[model samples]
Target: MFKGDLTVAAAYLTPAGGAVVTSVSPVGLADRAANEVSFTTSLGFPKKLERILHNPRVSLAYHTREHGFATHSHYVLAQGRAAVDLQPSAQRLAELMDASELFLGRTKRGGVWDWLLREYHQNRVFVDVHPDRIAVWPDLSASGPATVTGAPWPRHPAEQEPPKNGTTPRVPVAKLARQIAALPHRLLAYQGADGHPVILPVTVTGHDETGLRLAASSELLPPGGRRAGFLAHGFQPQCVGVSMRTVTGWLTVEDGRALYAPHTSTGMTAPPNRLVTTVANGLLAKQGLRRAQRNGTTARLHDLAARHRAQGSERQPTAFEDAPAQSTRPQR
Candidate 1:
């Protein structure tokens, strides 16, 4: 089921009763001799690694286009335990890195591969996940339904409790507004027509008191008015800090854009961890520099930071009822 897919969305529990979901590209599946469906990922994502270490229970969702047709997309969600494998032999490490390079369409002779290999040797480790339950949607058409194996499918935590007072709870307008503006990227999680969850990265084009305006490619857009989850995360190197927020609501298509009106929201911030925070920020900076070089431009993190600040300051309050606010320091 994982064939031809470059990346997967991994979700794991946080110490604070919330969850974090992030995308990671798998090097390849583990040996078939193992009784579980396992895949490997690098440890460059310190926060995800730390969370997985603290809570091994995790879920992974992969979406793939069937035969290059967006409308024929299929998805798989696997619930598993993510174990850190720190002591792989040098040969195994080399093999894993080579596989990753191939998956990313990079050749051994490429300068990009050389730089990536150096980074992997310096900061990467492997995470191997053992699936306990698996669900597959072979087609996303309206007639399709998810097929489950290994264990009974579990309902999402958000759906376990009914909304209070016949309406979804609202979050503090300013807090949600700031979070919507500060993060550089947003992740959208929604159920496909086949009734399986699909997660994809999207761009937040605009925001207001009512909701956020999302700009997604036609291929990534879900059915109109579908319930979906939106997540944003940001890190500050100078402060050695990180923040994450998730908002869920109904998404409607209008004027060729998706409008999401948040009903429930949760956010959390981590105390500064100097070493990990610095490493994470440096990795992100290097990636930004590579993208800038490829595009023949000189953009930097500070420039993006300034733009986020300007956007956050201009945010207006929403009309929703007040809710307890989470503290989020401005990114530097």
Candidate 2:
């Protein structure tokens, strides 16, 4: 839990209702005090904040081994409810300084820098999720059964009927397959019975009319068919130069094999220039804030002040304290 710098995080949504989105998320572990895990997002990113406010049920998948994050840990999945703080107190932002700088280099606050990044750094939201279920696989392959700690696992919902008028991958198979091959890293997400999303590592075997052929062990997959999100992403050292492609659609698992029918696809590519990246981030944040204003998300706030109020009297756990020590499954 402590070692990771970033995770591929999921927030649930639907098509008619919307769609679930997953992204590169960095949860500041050093700032997590008193037995809770959390990640911070810019108030500028209105869509993500709105979704979390709508459905607090979310998940974080910690599998990064490169760029110096989560290197010692096996693939871990944490599913739980998220409590959001849209209007943060100065005290909360003050508490986040150390961990924030540790993952993302030091904050450069000055004349032009302060004015440029005002909304991005100052106007932000924090989300805390206390895991109801934490599952671990031996490694990123996710080839065998996971050692889990939480409430009893739900029965496989195999008999439940699939959604009517299921969606298909709108993008051409050949085009996306090439892109997927270039970006080898992959993650798959689907909502659990409790509505919290579950994401695990997967491999792309090939592609056809059924969408991308996803390969992973049967134990890791949710049985039968359902709507799901797929992410193919890669990053260079020090989190420089990155690319990602996200797909949302139907996921069908049978005979120990799975197929992902992508309904929609979106992506971004960035070069290895830090200055350019920083500039782009500021611009995007400003635009996102405006979008939120237009959509009225800025007006609705779900305040989570319980933790901040108790900060003075509570004792925060050290990095290794929260995760359970026992492993129910054999490690390689």
Candidate 3:
């Protein structure tokens, strides 16, 4: 849709009760992630449009090359509402003018036509279409199609396949752990308690979603401090059968070697209890832990610790409390 150019041939039932032939240029392509596209056009006969479109009803159509020897005409009709927008920042207008020459391959000289051309940019209007009806058909003839049908298009064979046998292999956890441990100082940056920047030694730990379960040590986490450390781990790229979000696996680390085994019986539980409980309930179902018994533990611990944190001990409160605080704080 972003690659082709369409010419605006005419407008009907407009304010002046006449037709205008002008062109509308495509401005931008859709951001695939967000699903949106934008464009700009000129109403060549402004007086005629303003007069006829007291209740505007307009249709737009374009022809584009499709598969070999076939072409398609796309049509959309918008009625009742059309808007005219004339606000553009100086930077925006300059960029638009510059882009116009690059795209259209022409520039205007002195005269009323030049003035009109510049006004087309400076006063360029917007027609927002909220179409009540839309129809698209693959047409081979420029004369347009006489009938439309809703039928499944033909599909090529060899596009179908059966599921493969056996599970996919992952990048060994040992390699991942080594990468984290030997992670270069070039990428390390941190800030101190006073908001001044500092660099700290990196401590690597293998974690699967719920939390990082590094050995309880004074070096990794100081004895008097909270047992908290950052963890970074993701699904091995070659693990074809597993998705990072849904995979149930163990991150085995021993003697500086690590391995990720999918469809295993191991469960990762991060501390302070509640987060670990939730992750265990969701992903660790295959393990023998009973749901009712686990829920009892999580609720009891939460009730016991909720009031304790209110007394202002510990570096941070539980995750459930942290979420509400983040939401209530207004953005700057």
Candidate 4:
């Protein structure tokens, strides 16, 4: 299903136990025998990289839509351990770029490939992921179990070694509440019947010391009560910093509202140094200039660069905390 599509979302755990989900482009997929997937990204070390380095466990989701009289889609979720290869062979990088160009229908010699090659050579890393479990929803409307494969979904590594005694550390619900209130956006990820992960940008309707009240579409809520992943992240461009919080728990729909009982929660942040931020900002400016030239726009590049600088300088920091875990008793 991922053959031609480049868009995919990767979810990984931060040191603080938060899950960071972000959009990524799959440069290439290894053969089933190899049991690995590869993607390429900018050279600068981002927050996601930190999470992956600290914890190799990750989840990757991909889906494709068919539009027409009757809309339909197919989705897959691959839970795996990702290894970041900082020094991949140049030949491998070239092959991946070639595959990306072919999938994008770009000319082999020049065009986007040329620019991508230059960028790849200058700064880029390849992340190879090995799947441990895969779940698929072939049809969205079908009320059936997802086709599951591979090993059972492992609990967060931290959970494996619960404190010496049986008692676990109590999550600070009040702290989390305050953090959620400050977040500008929330993302909810659920598995659709069609075997794909659906990520929705939602608004936090209300929150208390216990849990959060989120506004979500009933369609995204699976029937018979199921769990979903929620993530909230804030970007502070001025300081080139990012903070993210994650929750995994059961979701229920009642009276047109969704109640979330967060089972596990975690949070983390990435604050780059001033030198790194300046370099990144410069890269952003150069990219904008290239885009403007390609689009035949005049002097828009500088404007775009200025806008980025202003947004970075002014955006506020967002804080996040973990939500309290809900009971495992089956929902009625």
Highest TM-score: which candidate? 2
- Per-residue lDDT of 150-263 in model 2, one digit per residue for the tens? 654565544235556655666787787887687757888776665667677888888887688888767768777777788888776545577888877778887878888877
Q: Which ten residues in a row have the lowest lDDT in candidate 3?
A: 323-332
Per-residue lDDT, model 3, residue 118, is 48
Which RMSD values do the candidates have, in order?
Answer: 17.1, 5.6, 31.2, 16.5
Ranked by lDDT, the better of candidates 2 and 3 is 2
TM-score of candidate 3 versus the correct structure, residues matched by position: 0.30
- Steric clash pairs (candidate 3): 14-52, 14-53, 15-51, 15-52, 15-53, 16-51, 16-52, 173-258, 173-259, 174-258
Most lDDT-accurate candidate = 2
lDDT of 3 by residue, 1-332 (tens): 22232222123232212122222343321122322123444333244334323433333332322211112243211111223232446676666666444334344456643543444455443443322222233331222332221211112111112114222223344443444442221111111122111111223345443323343212112221111112222221111111111122222334433333332212122333433333432333323123423546324333433443344322111211211110111111
Compared with the true structure, all predictions reach lDDT values of: 0.52, 0.66, 0.29, 0.51
Ranking by lDDT: 2, 1, 4, 3
The sequence of per-residue lDDT tens digits that candidate 4 reaches over residues 243-326 is 567766555555667666666678765554544543454465457445645764423323443453354321111100111111
- For candidate 4, the 10 contiguous residues with the lowest summed lDDT are 315-324
Judged by whole-model lDDT over C-alpha atoms, candidate 2 comes out at 0.66
> In model 2, which regions exceed 4 Å deviation?
11-21, 30-33, 69-71, 159-164, 301-322, 325-332
